[model samples]
Target: MKHGVTVALLVVAAMAGTMASARAQGGRIEERALPYTPLPADIQALDEVIKAPLTDDFVAKSFTAPDGRIVPYRLLTPATATVQLAQARLPLVIVLHGSGSIGQNNVSQMTAFAKAWALPALRQRFPAYVVAPQVDVRSADYAPGGDGLLASHPGASLPAILALVDDLLGRLPVDPARVYVVGFSMGASAALDALVAQPGRFAAAVAFSAVPPDRDRAVAVAGTPTMQVHGDQDTENPFDPDHAWAEAVAAAGGAPIFVRYQGMEHRVPPDMILAPGWREWLFAQRLKSAAPFPNP
Candidate 1:
């Protein structure tokens, strides 16, 4: 009887030890999966090259989003002479393209920004880590009005964009405080959706020719600094709601700057992206006091 009791006690102790070990292992795995954590060495090197000097040679790569969907993106590193000699952990800009380029090859969307505005400007003065993620809308359903699906799904395009940011952060040294987002047309709606889904994640967001979402939970993004640019002649998305969006953002205690261009249309003009004072305006704005919108 004494031997049986001792054996029983020993078994209980062993089982408890096993359980503790299992819990510890689980916690480690969870931490490893977190988004903002530093990535492995190989990924870090690749990120550095992406932000390095541009010598008439550009590289494009593809990464898998958290939802297991492949997203193609382009990275243009400024030439060594162009890069700021003192700055480390370069600033990042994530660009979202319009609906016309949605189902097309990622190169079309990438070149639109990379070759158009980002690379040219960076080659002259500022060198930034630019990311253009192509959203594959072939598999996802869209509302009749061309907006995102009303029902939420795991692998939707908007979520895929967010996941792209997570993947980039894990693989690169991105400045959390200086991350910026720019979207056009359908992409503008996606930008607004992203801001609504995750508040305070971006330093600044610029949306051009955009329509406000049907139902935006303002409380989610009360702290994000945003810029709305609309052409007065735009008919597809219109400019009236752009004004309304700015008002709603202000009411939510956020500083939303709205720009209405004269004689502009639904297209994103080069002047809009290359405006002399635009970057200054974007950099000067700061994210301040973000409180939830009062319930009506």
Candidate 2:
């Protein structure tokens, strides 16, 4: 009888130890292996799933402009996007990538900002529409504007982008008043283009590592809520001119929220995007405003 009691106690202690080990390794998820029962069909399915790109996260797609230009893009639909759309139209978040993410393949820009939006926790917290488009143009395509501004006929893709938006709205659901656009580097210039070219279209915009457009276009989108983020020590794009441009926009009644990352270079910082109030602040901007505020 004592031997039996000792054996039962040992079994219970072993399970307790196993439970404690799991609790201790909660944050170190990488040490865990893929659990499998080793059934034939299960093993084959796992192999196939592991080999394929994460389709549930984002999918490669293309759009053709009215002028016959083929613009390749990647679309990311949050798992709850459809459900959220049903209850209330979700906002559209357009993400544009920098020069390094430029390519004809349409996959570079997808990965640049896709991970941030596709994060499981972020997706659950804020489900919305996200579009990342890839452009093939390079340095030569950009035309120099007066003092610290680069210009491009970004209107070229406006048609295709609108078409995609319309298609999404028809099939899914969208909050027309909450449309927002965000971009980085070269993409920032494009965001300015969209803002200027299509005023009253976007509720708010976020630009990173970008200078303003020409002096004339800078004030064209006045009253539009905008957030401009730049690095003060940016060697490639420089900072003095963009800082002045942001000041000029503020003076022109745009009143853009400017965030210059001190001592940082020309790159997007994780803290700026993932910080606590960032998501709420970005989604809370509205187009109708009598008194606009600008932060320096």
- TM-score of model 1 relative to the true fold? 0.68
Give a tens-digit lDDT track for model 1, residues 37-150. 122442343343345443224467787767787787776665566464636555567777776766536566643334444434434455567777776772222242223313
lDDT of 2 by residue, 1-296 (tens): 10122221233224323423432333211111111122344334334434445444777787776767677877777675446456756777888777787677877665424556765556677677788877765411255666545544463555566565555545545577777888887777677777877777788877777755665666677566666677777887666655665666656655555565667787765443333234555676655632121221
Candidate 1 Cα errors over 4 Å, as ranges: 1-58, 82-84, 111-114, 118-121, 138-155, 285-296
The residue pairs found clashing in candidate 1 are: 53-78, 53-79, 54-78, 54-79
Please give each candidate's TM-score.
Answer: 0.68, 0.71
lDDT of prediction 1: 0.55
Q: In order, what lDDT does every prediction score? A: 0.55, 0.59
Q: Count clashing pairs, candidate 2.
A: 0
